[model samples]
Target: MSWPHVIPYANPIYFLWLAVALLPMIFMLLIKGKRWGWYQSLITLIFLYISFGGKYWQQGLALIGYVIFQTLLVWCYHHYRQQKNASGIFYLAVALAILPLTLVKVIPFVDGGAAAIFGFLGISYLTFKSVQMIMEMRDGTIKEYHPLRYIQFLLFFPTISSGPIDRYRRFEKDLLEPPTREVYAGLLNRGIWSIFLGFFYKFILGYYFGQVWLPLLNKSLMHQGFFSWSLILYMYCYSMYLFFDFAGYSLFAVGVSNLMGYDTPKNFNKPFISDNIKEFWNRWHMTLSFWFRDFIYMRLMFTLIKKKVFKSRIVASNVGYFALFMIMGVWHGLTWYYLLYGFYHASLICLTDAWLRFKKKHKKQLPSNKFTKALAIFLTFQAVCFSFLIFSGVLDQLFFHH
Candidate 1:
């Protein structure tokens, strides 16, 4: 028995697999007929290609089976659109379609097939987009639903792997009218820049640090404590690693989307530089934060706050901040670590807001200059790293006192 080493790569197998899979999309771009059908098939294929990788073949028949079902869903939505104009019907259809994914994702939680079935890499994203598309269709926001375009939108390879999570409207706009040459060039340039930066951080720097630190960090947590000050230090390292890690992925997603002529949302905007937690969210995983804000926060704010439950700024501030970041944690994954991740972030944001308000009472003494900006960036970065520590679950190890 020996320690086995596996090397990660921009492997040729992966590239060839992608090339073969994306052929249909290329054909769709060039040919002038039945664009939607070709595009949908291409999208689905790309999803499979990117998500499964070399091991994707293990589930071969089942994977194909899933795609086929989703295709029928595409047709069903198209036909439903043709027959009726009710937005609720489309929403219902999407809701119905999601049951399969929900079942697949949730069942393994109690069953034995967790890896084979549950915890699918891309299902979370695909499900979100599918629901979004149908809702948009019903709302009159999307005037038409070609089955192919629907497939293409849901399964586009670049986004399928992981996503910056574009909405259907933007994808539809791109499909009907892609960017101009200059735009494509800009996209390509951006994509390249993004990928380079992402790889350097995620791959190069991340690899070196993880190789040296993760094992030690893991050991320290068990020997030390999970909630102690020791965690505060390793949490910093975890935060750094997590930043380069996820930021790298987001960078790739943005760059890749741009090259493909679709404008996925900007996922990060130097979030560590933000002066407040709300602003930090704006700067980090910028997409998910907004997704929760747009789809969850604003709606809840409208519905919940208006009811006048103890109406106070302090109350509203705490409630809104808690709900936002907790959901943000849950969005990371359906796990306890993620749940705590949300709690940690919400705490920071709440405390930060409280401090700001307190500082406002003594406004003239507050720092305001380049130094302040730099300090804000440093503090935000550290705060975010603390969030990452929770996210990574190492906080349980590093801070353990028992």
Candidate 2:
């Protein structure tokens, strides 16, 4: 038997089904001030089925196995962390947690563009959560292991595919305690507003910029060739398209989670208004950037400093930025463009750091003003748009495929 399938937030029609599925949960949360666990579980499974069932059954099977694998690994690590404080065991567990995702990412490159059998959408996000849990276990932050709850956190349909990446402990607390009536009323209001705003950003602006204007811009650019007026138009158009499309999806995830009384973290925060590349990262993809900062960069810096790997703190930090962004780039894909995009951002960030330091040293000489801040924002915006053009893979298409 065939089943209906839909990508989460892919179109307006999906929202109709989402509204139907979420209405009961929303009503219950509003009336009773508590969510029905079984009902929520049923909703999660139904959505999962819609997302990965039918022709995507293979992905569904992979998701099941992946969840079970991570759950068991986390359980074992939790037990070990309780009994022992060995770093090797913790590192091994973290590696094991990410191994499936690594294979999934690597397989397509080696197998002539064939996806890994164990691959599914959201594998990367799931791995991030699992690794986080294992790290917390190692640090004794996550004191106890509850397999069922852990699975629920991993399988939470909202923000599962792309994430604002909630911490396990935060999620657990929200799950255990529904918000107060007053708090829930505010949350419901915000949730409804976010959904409406998402429709405007996604269904309206995203469709106009991405589906409508992007193709026309691309066609114009092709005729005009590189470095033409059309190329400049394509750059800005693609950047806006990406922002609205992704920001819209994230708003939906957060809104839906809010309706269920879970306060999922917000992802975007007016990234284009940033004065520098460093600020842009803090605003854009806030969760992913913060994840790398917490899990990878911070830890790596600690290790380096502890071992005296670099005499200069500046050198150490610059190296850390490169490593962090490079890993992030490769995580996006194995493609050359993705790798270069990562390096490009890393370079910009490092340069921004250097400039900030120089300005600090020359405080009297370099005056800060509103006009300077505005200029900085404009320059940073252009730089970001160019990077997005690289990320769009248009260069690859223009050069390699042609």
Candidate 3:
């Protein structure tokens, strides 16, 4: 039997009604206790009742797999922490987890969805969430985990497909701890407003982009001489497109989580206004970059210094830049192109640092032309776009592989 035929009331609009109806109970249950065991049990039953229609067995088994893997990963990290105490081991562990999950995403035999990369349900979301968790663990910022909360953290329906990638420390405490009525009211309004914006972005703008621009890009894919320039120009537009699409997705996540009384992490911060590539990263996907900085970069930088590569400040800075971005690239995917993208960025960082060093060495002899400022902007943007060109995976498709 089909899902709709079997589940009777499983239509799309029914989901919105179910969500609106359940919101108050979820909020009350969340505010009631340290552990929402009762609430969770009830919800699991509801999921069982729906059962993906007759495919319930497969969905249940898939969930069981997630619990087993996620639990073991957390346990292993706990064991690692007891031994090393360095904390950066967390990002390394996260990267390791990504390898297996990436395999599971790409290699269909492992998790049954061989054709679709996102087959393991929330693989994309969990990958980013794993990064967030490991980052907090490394920073010594995460104090505890309630299994129920953690389960809900991963399975929160709104963000299960895509994400804002909330940090454990930021979410766990707020979730376990209750907020004041004023805080709840404010959060409610903010959540509603953000979700409203997200819907407009997704339904209105994203739909338009998919209908108009996406078809054009697909058609231009084969004969991309002029189209490549057009595609590159389109990417600047598509960058804006991606921003709204994903940011809209994030807002949708935050709003839904807020209604449940959980405070999610902020993911974006007016990225376009950023003056430099460094600042651009900070403002864009703010949560993910900070995860890299706190867990990956700081630990690697200090670890190198601890190992004596940092004896000279210049060598240490360059090494730090390269190592961090390398991990950044790897985090994006388990691909050679991602690795190259990492190196490309690392080289740019080295140039940026060296420029600062040279300027300090010859501060009195500097040029004072308006042209210099304009040139810097042009170069920095070009650098960002070129890096995008590499990671876009389009270049790999077109050039060397063929």
Compare the candidates by lDDT and give the number of the best one.
Answer: 2
By TM-score: ranked, best first = 2, 1, 3
lDDT of 1 at 373: 73
lDDT of 3 at 374: 65
Q: Which tens-of-lDDT digit does each residue in 230-325 have in candidate 1?
A: 567677766677677777777766765654556778787876668777798878777666666775567567656788775785787678778887
Candidate lDDT scores, in order, read 0.65, 0.91, 0.65
Cα lDDT tens digits, model 2, 202-238, are 8899999999999998888777677688888899999
Measured on C-alpha atoms, candidate 3 has an lDDT of 0.65
TM-score of 2: 0.97
User: What TM-score do all the candidates reach, one by one?
Assistant: 0.77, 0.97, 0.76
Candidate achieving higher lDDT, 1 or 3:
1
Tens digits of per-residue lDDT for model 3 on 9-108?
A: 2234534644764575556644652335466447544543353324545544555566567756765786688578664676667767566466764565
Winner by lDDT between candidate 2 and candidate 1 = 2
Question: What is the Å distance of residue 44 in model 3 from its true position?
Answer: 7.5
